[model samples]
Target: MKYQFDKDFLWGVATASYQIEGAYDQDGRIPSIWDTFSKTPGNTYMGHNGDEACDHYNKFKEDIALLKKLGIKAYRFSISWPRIFKDGKYKLNEKGLKFYKDLVEELKKNDIKPIATLYHWDLPQILQDEGGWSNPEIIKYFVHYASVMFNALGDDVEQWITFNETSVFLYLGYLYGIHAPGIKNLDLTLKAIHNVHLAHGETVKLFKNSNYKNQIGITLNLSPNYPYSVEEKDIIAAKTNDAFWNRMFLDPILKGSYPEEILNNPFGNTLKEIIKDDDMEIISHPIDFLGINYYSRSVIKHDENETFKYKSIPQDGEKTSMGWEVYPDGLRVLLNYIKENYGNIPLYITENGAAYEDKLENGKIHDIDRINYLKRHFISAKKAIDEGVNLKGYYVWSFMDNYEWAEGYVKRFGLTYIDYETKQRILKDSAKWYSQVIKNNFIEE
Candidate 1:
């Protein structure tokens, strides 16, 4: 094993509001899209909802204790918009505010850096009533919401992410109808993407204008797309997939414009109309760092009649419990691509991990597959750093097993497995392995 990371590289784990922080109805917190969608019949798998996910809301201190025990240097978590603003307005939810305040303080007390995310796909139901991201009004609301958190916790938290995977939210929620506020409308999906970019721009502007002492960035789930074949058609399919999945968000934020390929497509003009003057400047505001969430590489082929004209094919390799391919090199490829395309901005692996169905026996979860998945990817990350990619941190996808959205509780992506029925948490073998990595700042054979 090599000590390739910087001495101060962040080691941590991440969790979202709707996925882990239950108490959905308590403390003046209003319903979010997840709350509404999960409650609706036949929406979530097996009629499951995150009504009491991991009970993190009530046990954050204990959770932080686990992070301390794991020797993690940072913790990235999302702030529930509906919890902070029951109606998406300034009427403060004292209890909701206090919850996060205390959580941050606890992390700080344990010498753990806190990375706060403003939104993680948990839009307040009130905002959803008014077209959600499809309406431009969300820009102002999101800015205000960001301001509130900045004013409340900026002193302690030095790393801030505006939106966690906005592309996923728009695509899944609006296009695929898998997540909350599910609606399968292509036109609306495109509109929602534009609105989300605008909202991100507004929030970035707000953070800059406030003179906050912190770094602001966006976390994007980027995959290295591979064409199914070397043929010209397959190559063209790969380019299209990159334009939509990777460049659609990256180009605008990093280059201040949409990818030319996407802008020249049949729906290109529609995207152009949505991009307003000065929007790019707001979106591209000089940030201190960018967060990349890499899971697997995508193998795609062209399909003219198919939506987006690129269909994902299964990879001929090992798979995670979630059925995603295990491709550590994809992480290295994406890291170098960002460095070449987006300049030398510092980057963080804000979310990386695999799901595994591990059965606990004798009071322990011997999840060897997850441990191997993490070790291989961490080596890939080390390779990136050795190759001069200014990588800053690595945070596993989650700390505790909780309600996975859409897939429900079926997919477990945590170091600590949560018995949903008993609310008992058992640390898996991966947790112990990760603890050693964090402690030594390197993996040992």
Candidate 2:
């Protein structure tokens, strides 16, 4: 069976600035929250830092050649905020600006569209020092940053995403103390969530008000929640999980309102008090598309003694290298749910790939598991499209292996394997499979 997509359907790969672009302090680049967080003792796994990630900062041409070799139509990369504003102010860094400009030009030379992300969890440390996303002033600063990028690359870059996975950043960084600026406080996390939504809304408005001819949207790590049982308690628990994880951002952005169920949780009333008039209007900025990064799903069951009063039950199924359950049907369900609730907004699978223990042998990596993982999800995505989901693109989570955040370099989620010691990129079997998929523009089973 072969599934064909629209001729213009985008096929791409994604990587973040800090994850791939090493040269942490080079060319007037300042420290970001990741830098501070990783440097602090006991923050990151194995004390891993992005000091010399993939050296993409210096070898961007080589990376572009790789993308061209893959026959990719688009490449989604992020711009570092601290690189643009060294002091976390409106002051532009010419060297940092020129680096990305050169990269974008190189992509254009290869006929690859540059899908630029404004932020990808690399907030300037200066902003962090000033309360970061918890501060309302950060909204203005972010808008200014967005304006600078829009004006700089607006002519060439046609696809723009304001931020990547605010929920992950807020919940992990603040609530779980796992990522940057590690703080374990729910109130601060909630505050950060509010401010990030505000910033995203403001940035979207800024892009719309600009003279750029492009599509603007935001990317979210969306996972659909399923009930563990048909029992009433389990069903209600699933609903609550949906309100917390999915609807928290989707409802505000798509429906112009936060989920009433969220406000009725233990902290619900307090959250309502924190929400001000017109905030929802700001968050409800019209977007050209919604980027969905789906990997797996969670089954929820009622738990009276659990921290959130509901527990996520792991299905008895195969798991990924990251310990995430492998459930491809969840992607179809999520896309269908979004289509039904979000009014048929154009959507893109911005990041959907699995991590597997990749082993390099004889200068080649045979990651059949990754190939199978992607194949299953691609089929699921195709099913969603066939069922009338407006999915416009599908980008693998990573093009090459680089830093894996708190887990450091342990988890490999890339089609190309990287030698951390030598910074060498070796195309794995999955890369070849993915390239073939791009060449055909459809996967055949």
**Displacement of the residue 163 alpha carbon in candidate 1, Å:** 0.5
lDDT of every predicted structure (CA atoms) = 0.88, 0.89
Q: Which ten residues in a row are the worst by lDDT in model 2?
A: 264-273
Q: Per model, state how many residue pairs clash.
A: 0, 1
**What is the clash count of model 1?**
0
Q: RMSD for all candidates, in order, please.
A: 1.2, 1.1
Expressed as tens digits, the lDDT of each residue in 233-340 for candidate 1 is: 878899889888899999878888888887788778777787778888877777778899999998989888886777888977799988899999999999999999
- Stretches of candidate 1 exceeding 4 Å from the true structure: 1-3
Model 2's alpha-carbon lDDT is 0.89
Off by over 4 Å in 2: none
lDDT of 2 at 112: 94
The deviation in Å at residue 180 for candidate 2 is 1.0
TM-score of 2: 0.98
Q: Give candidate 2's error at residue 27 in angstroms.
A: 0.5
Worst 10 residues of 1 by lDDT: 1-10
Residue 255's C-alpha lDDT in candidate 2?
84
